[model samples]
Target: MNYFFSHFHVYRSSNMILLLFLLVLHQQHYFIKPIYAYSRVEDLAINCGTESNSIVLANKRIWIGDATNSKHFSVLESSPQKNQSSISVATPHRDDPYGTSRISHYEFTYSIHGVTPGHKFIKLHFNPASYPNFHPSKSVFSVKAGPYTLLRDFNASGAAQEHRDHHHHSDPNKILLIEYQHCIKVEPGQNLTLTFIPNTTHKDSYAFVNGIEVMSLFKYHDQCNKQKKSRFRFSEVVHHEESCMNCSPSAQPPPSQTKPASISGGVLYCVIAVSVFISMSSIFLLCIWVWRNSRMKHKAKMELIYEETTNSRKSSITLASGNSCRCFSIIEISAATINFDDIFVVGVGGFGKVYKGYIDDGTKPIAIKRFIPENGVQGVQEFKNEVEMLSQLSHPHLVPLIGYCNDEDDMIIVYDFMANGTLRDHLYGTCNTPLSWKQRLKICIGAGLGLEYLHSGAKFKIIHRDVKTSNILLDEEWVAKVSDFGLSKIGPNGESKFHVSTEVKGSLGYLDPEYSKTKRLTHKSDVYSFGVVLLEVLCGRAPLLRKVEGPKRCLVEWARSCQSEGPHAIDQMVDPFIRGKIVQECLSKFVEMALNCVVHEGNQRPSMGQVVEGLELALQLQLKSED
Candidate 1:
């Protein structure tokens, strides 16, 4: 009886310990947490356009129009991308937003930057609905992203027809958009450069893209190694307008190597290609159709000048502050520029070339901009807009517009020559000497003042559509001035709404995600760009440089990451060259102000005036450090 009692007591004690252990685990589940080794991140969904914003399509957000060392296709410069007809293609199931706009060139390259680099999925969307004048056969094009050649001499319409055959004759007319997605390994901090080259054999001789989507999946190249056979594999998503959506699963794998099907090798390869093309083309048609209906109704958007007359009364534009724009006659401008001579060529930009010239009896040095029509539709629009915006707006921070000449085909404007070139040239660009910390702060202050003027100083609010380091020009006195006005647009007109929906325009790294998504043009968009400039000025880095490491590659991403880890972490983010020159408090304040400007939500961003105020505080701190 004693042995039995002892054994029972031991068993009960063991059971009690087990119950206690369970209780601890349950309590820990609610209270104390174990550090997890891995986290399941949300899949990245990136949709962008070349010119139009996210509203161009309900699916796209991350617009990609501005490119370094690239030419933008004018909407009418090259024949239309497709036959945009509702009768032929049927109304898009969804209300398409892009209208009938597409960017095309003989050879165009797009560099998609500031992305989560890894093995990500890419969906190249196209609207190949041909115009009546364009030849469907001439739609042949090729695409190369990184080292991967996704398409070669591809006849978009032919691919769509094959897609139709593959789909067993689905609603052919309803198809407008087509999507083709493939998995590829991305090196850390690598910008995806997509080269679209028109096939020489094709008569159309131009390439275009209406929409693009990028999804970041795994964050390592090894993801490709793990699934080598399937890495290059792709699936298709076909969106015919807003309503009709269809998705085709991955194409069946090619016949086995060891035990092939009874089909001949040539036949087998052809069959495999057909199957893949069928899938790709179906999805591709879905992407192309959205523009046809909306485009037909909005053809006059190009003619519409969404602007304000800064100089409405006379030849000389009178500014609100009484600054006058001296309009030059065509004869006078010709004498000044010497007929747009190559010898006078000073700089080149998205649409035209700049020439150093002389006016006022060859006494005053000036920069003359000559537009190239073939560059794209934005060229003419930019020229007109620049003249109008520059004439009306005047500030110490803005580059002074001396005069403009619009005589027949001679479209040109003259401005005070910026002897120091771009602010970019001074910061690790052409200029050899690194700007001192004090000098840098002064320049930042000047830039902020210029942006502030654009946002509030003028009678009408203006948003500089393109704000980047390169656009900030430095004059002979080392005074920084905001220059480019081609992308500038009038801010929202309605008092009720905070933003105006406009076509997306801006550089890759500096683009505001909020504006990219909502197509809302606001003063806040410029703030985000200024934040990028602040980071660049502090770090002496390019906005997006593939040559750098993954973490430090994109200035915006790198700074944001560093800021999140506290001010000490920002130490690592600052430029090594400028580290000792910076005061800790000033540097921290500057970074805090910058990060605040670039917040994902526009409302959270401070105005240019606020940014200026913060800079003033930073200046005081810098002065204290110097003392």
Candidate 2:
């Protein structure tokens, strides 16, 4: 009896130890298993509508074509024809995935299997081109991923045209490719299927795709965790996905995977109870550490960006007495702008929305420019540059900087409100009355003076790189002021420097051909852009009228052609509103000066000072003709 009792005691002790080990593993199973499974999964990129071999891009990403017959994806369509011809002109993308696309006249589906269960990034590539008998305009279709609607009645050609028009791209032959991206969640054992349905309501409508990319969210999270320098957060991507899904939860996991609960004895219950208490305590402590660490890191990053911007402008700020550019808090800005209500939005541009708000307790009016957060480093640089440049320089013709707000993720600039809005608003695209001949000449003179001040009168020579009508704002008295110094650059201080070699950046159609070709920016580059603005003022139209056909499509080319046809041909091109109002002599002198500013060589283009003087002369002639 003593021997048997001793052996039973040893067996019970061994059972207890094994039970504790099993309990610890059960507590961590949910967290550890998913991570391990995610690491094993890989990203996928497929070239659609092609039977060609796999393609290797410069970025070292291998893209498998549909012809590979990979188990990862299967197409419902039996025969998908490849794009007959490649894009004839140079495209924006470095890779040529757009060369071969899968075009379908009827509905089709792509069943993608083996995707790991998690949030995934879906990228659909499209090249809007005329494929064989398929017209680009007729390629209107809807896309769906399971229960989610990715796109509805989407027109690729219209979208491409809109993009071209927005950027003022004058080249009609330039191809515009598009890549639509979305984030989605996949449940366990659920295959991702993409369906492309043609719009049956529209006659001859079809669907096409150039490429498809499926990337796991864990891949981004893993990279983010590995690289301390990366600013992107996995949480932010998940937030974006949630927003894309309209804040709806993902579909429930398959019911077949659900397991039944089994009854346990009193001893097993006691083991589970102890494990639950210990596991909850450990998880709580870990979460606290992670949250604190993330907060500290985020704070440090924001401070770094702020410090860099402040340090770069220290010299400029010191020169300007430090108080010239005030710093406003986000709270004050939000209160003044009514929390950025749509009704308060006075203007919208590439940077962001401009809100007209009351500051200093509704006594003072201010124009607040909110920078788009997604603009990232480029937007930050612009914000810094504008503040640095504007703080040091002050002139009546230049818009006054009231203050700025760099609170948290918001980068905002406060400026003196212009009652009359932009010069473009008055020139066209509005019902505002056209300015008289003298008024137009005076506005031109004021704008020219602003550009001249930037080129010569400033403490340091500055070049207003983006000189366009839209950047010229008019005040209550109709006085023109140069605005948007984000693109401005400090030019050669003396004759010794000559030019600043930099990447070309300006609105298309107004970009200086010489500067674009050589990548050498100079004061004459601004002069060329101002010349385009001058043409805009004279013709009362945009720099490029996409609707106009042939040579008449481009204002500059059409103007040059008219000038070549003799002096009489030039008069026919004047804006009808000021047709007879302009003195012939004044018009001739103005046209000659404007043309001189846009000459082929920078050396041939007239200086900003000369432009100011010539405009003043034209104004004098107009006044003399009135007398």
Candidate 3:
């Protein structure tokens, strides 16, 4: 009896260990449950433009036709009298549910009802090819699911071409199919509505879709919540002439009926009770373990990052006002930006979007730059550099750094807002009022002063690696402030070291030819970029015009050629808005200074101080001319 009991104890211990091991593996996603294992509360697949009762695809999904729609959905058209039509494709790709598509010249909507509320995967299928009367190029549209804008001014042909180019396909005429997938949460009892609107800005534009699928996934709640915390909120609904049609009770499909299991009441009750208790106990223990492990890992990671940042040299630098830069929490940043709503977006750049936000109880206006790590390490390094450099340096002509947020995986920087926007906005783009010749001169002088300070006034010689009109911001008082220091670099510290040997990184067309060839960075490289900006301000044209051909494509080369031709040619190249406003002497001096800064050799370029003096002289000459 003792031997038998000892054997039983060993057996039970081994089984319990195995069970714990399996549970840990499941928590780590080592064991992926099959699709059929999920309790799918809702599944919808529509074969658009088809009249068939049912079609089974290769993926084992059953799709019903939307043409003879039952109570599940109702389609509303912008023009009920004209009515949108359906067309069949000549060649359909393999595994395609149906070759037909519903095409619309105007806006349309689909209201789907009776969907069990949760996070759903929304899929939209598109075939970029010519139809009977519709062409792929003209198929430009926007798609919206409730308040979320899935696609804005989307062009299927361009997307398909990009897909082909990405795969290195030489054949440009290949028919390509594309699918866009998005995940959205639907509150309980709320219906799902999808709107398709043609790009009204483009004439003769249309919208088309081949299929639509909406299915519930079991593990979407955590993912959706995380996404919401990281990204901006959904945009408002798109305004259109047609209104969305609501589904009535009679239009909804009949409730699904499930058969009851036949078993002895007493035995079934006991079995269910035991199963529920065991399952709940196991799940509760697993949750605790997972939570504790994740919490410990996250805490350690954050502490390491904080230690590194605090130990950095730049972090010790304090402002002249006796105030150091504050480290903001994610909650504070989110509150200031209103959870990064779309309406607060002021501008978009290579790194990410900039939001106009108010902080300190709406008293302090700030500009928040959210760094999105799209390029992985490069983006992260840039974010760190921006924080380090800006915190160490301060000047009246430089945009002030308010604070930063490096919580979790997010990287954000806050700055003093520039109410007047960028210099490029007034020079060529959309600003209705054009700056006078004198105003332009003053702005250039201010910007040059800022660069001079960075190059000489700072503790170490700093190079504004990227300098252009867009980076030159204007304030309410028209003071030109240099912004965007993500690419800025500290130049050689001692007199013996003339340049920093580093990889070339700057905007194209503004990049110095000598630096590009030698991989040597110096203040002269910034002078070269600033020279390009000088010409940009004078001609009111971009640094490089991709659409233009020959020397004219590059503003620097074209300006050089025009200067060689004489003052007459230079006058012709001037921006028409300020063509005759510039004095002859001022224009000649300005052109000479710009050309000297952009010479082929870095050593031949003017120093930042010299550039500042030249700009100041030009400004004085402009004032004399105005008098």
For candidate 1, lDDT tens digit of each residue in 482-563? 9989889888744777788888888899999899998888989999999999988888767887555687777888888887
Top TM-score: which candidate number? 3
Kindly list the per-residue Cα lDDT of model 2 for residues 541-578, writing each as its tens digit.
Answer: 78887676898788888889989998788888888789
TM-score of 3: 0.53
RMSD of each: 28.9, 19.7, 15.0
Please report, as a residue range, the 10-residue window in candidate 2 with the lowest summed lDDT. Answer: 230-239
lDDT of each: 0.66, 0.75, 0.76
Ranking by lDDT: 3, 2, 1
Least well predicted 10-residue stretch by lDDT in candidate 3:
228-237
For residues 1-627, what per-residue lDDT tens digits would candidate 3 score against the true structure? Answer: 564446456555656876997899888785664332445566778777777755564457777777775688877777555634434343344244436677878788878878776777687877766777777789999999877787888887676664443233444434556666666878777889889899988888999887788877443231232122111111112222334576566777678795665578767997687667556555666776798799999888767665554444233333345557878888777766656755457679989999876666655667899987443456667777887788878788998888888776678989888877789877764413668888888899889989999999997789989999989988878899999999999898756898999988898989999999999998999999999999999998788877667988899999999999999999999999999988998999999999999999889999889998998888888788668
Off by over 4 Å in 2: 1-319
Q: Is candidate 1 or candidate 2 better by lDDT?
A: 2
Q: Which residue segments of model 3 deviate by more than 4 Å?
A: 1-322
Clash pairs detected, candidate 2: none
